[model samples]
Target: MTTLTTPTAARLAGITRTLSEWQTADWKGFLHPGDLGWNSMAGAEKSAADLRCWTADGTVVAIGMFDGEDLFRMAMDPAALDDDELARQIEADLTSGRVLPAGTVTVEARGALALRKRLRARGWNEGEPWTPLRLDLRTPVPAHPRDAALRVEEIGLDQADDWISVHWSAFKGTPPSSDDRRRLVHRWTTMATGPFAHLAHHLIGYDNTDQPVAVTTVWTAGDGRPGLIEPMGVHGAHHGNGYGTAITLAGARVLQQHSASAAVVVAENSTAGALATYLAAGFTASEPVTDLIGSVTQRHP
Candidate 1:
């Protein structure tokens, strides 16, 4: 019997392990374990609270994370991709509000054909598309000309503040409040010390004036598995300076050092500039994939 339950710390670790094993040289648009690690920015406890797993015979077969109140991103074991029992169980829970609220919900299940087929039969439609890009780590990552002038550093606890500063400046575009800063610090601490810490690398780049201008976090599933660049950004003030490409190449180099088969990231199709940055860093783009959108009220029997 397949049962759905919120994960405890042990179960979450298991989910992370399974996700790592699921990564492949071929991009499948599945959830990366780094996605879970990135969510640690919300704090450890909250990250756990937002996760759910489906288990059968004492092993996790599917994992899901709620990305906000309406979007649920999920990945299943490759063996379970076409499992009808698991698909029906997931569909029922999703529609019955056991997993998400009883209303509109967006599910990112690009690799789960059975679940996606069920959702489509029940009236789900495609959401916005996202482009997946990858850099082969078998070859040395070509250096960007900007690499010559920028100093990239692998940061730790002492430099957590630097990471937080540039990350917020790049994404939020304003100074974070004291409370927000405190929370961001806690988030970084949790991630850096978490169970999967060995797989993570935090890097920050500085220009000639020693100003931190960009940041990236790279996570490896393990040797030979694809590595992920979950959230890479250049400070808004430094956008036109090629810092984005510089930081991205820095990340790919870290992945190669860790023996990753490839480095992968996803960008919303709307973010043309982000895609261009990866291209500039020697990454190749794959066909885009879209999330499945459905309303609970329209659930079919």
Candidate 2:
């Protein structure tokens, strides 16, 4: 359980780094407990040891853990092994504990196609890359988005339940049940205390009658960089309309008011149109390293 190691740990970490796929885990970037999409039953069983990673030679490569898209992050040590031989050894080490084990695996890569090609050759399926876009905060705010009828307003703290309901309804698909929605609202509301925390702040886009329809939450990373708008979406009934573009600008406006230099959005490739909408709102776009996720299930353990 103790990640504290001397020389041996260093070598294994070196190999893992050479064979690395993504680097977010290397930096301890775990998802918040209240974020949507994290499975509850899976969460209860995770512990520090689950984060404890090792090499085929029984050496520690890094320290970290993952829960689907929740609480997942890791870091590697490059000082431990020969750079040339790192990937092979580390790939073996990772598969040893079922990290990339069988079943239907979800792989997300935000940048680069070469690495994805390598992964594809190695039997891992690639997923569509979600583009990252940026909107200058100082730019003039354009007229509201024109599409389906919507009501945009600053959220009231007393409306946590409403936030949870709207987000749950908008984002419900595979994982992150209604229970996850409640916890997510709770985390965004009170439990989290950081610049990136937007629990107490958000922009709600509603239907003509003031019912919640689209939601966008704003938060800044600890590094004081541009604001981040994540998991923004509209209900199924509201898709293909200007609600997405309108609320995106609305959220960007809020972050700008808070003194953000720029606001960035990260979303699946399917969101390109939404990005275009943002451009119309005076924002620029950036191409991200796209990773295609694919998986081959082994018949037996």
RMSD, one per candidate, in order? 2.3, 8.3
Candidate 1 lDDT over 1-301, as tens digits, reads 8898887665667678888998987867688888888877656677788898888998888889988889999988888899888999998888777787768789999778899999999989998999889999998999898998789999999999889989999889997898988889888888888866877999999999999999999998988999999789888889988999999999999999999999999899998899999989888989898899888764333
User: For model 1, which pairs clash?
Assistant: none
Give the count of colliding residue pairs in each prediction. 0, 24
Using TM-score as the measure, the top candidate is 1
Task: Please state the error at residue 160 of candidate 2 in Å.
Answer: 1.7
Candidate 2 regions off by >4 Å?
1-93, 112-121, 138-152, 172-200, 206-208, 235-241, 271-283, 292-301
The positional error of residue 109 in candidate 1, measured at the CA in angstroms, is: 0.6
- Across residues 49-124, which tens digit of lDDT does each residue of candidate 2 receive? 2343544456554433444532223334435322324444444433443455555544332332232344566777
Cα displacement (Å) at residue 180, model 1: 2.7
- TM-score, candidate 1, is 0.94
Please report, as a residue range, the 10-residue window in candidate 1 with the lowest summed lDDT: 292-301
Q: Against the hidden reference, what TM-scores do the models get?
A: 0.94, 0.57
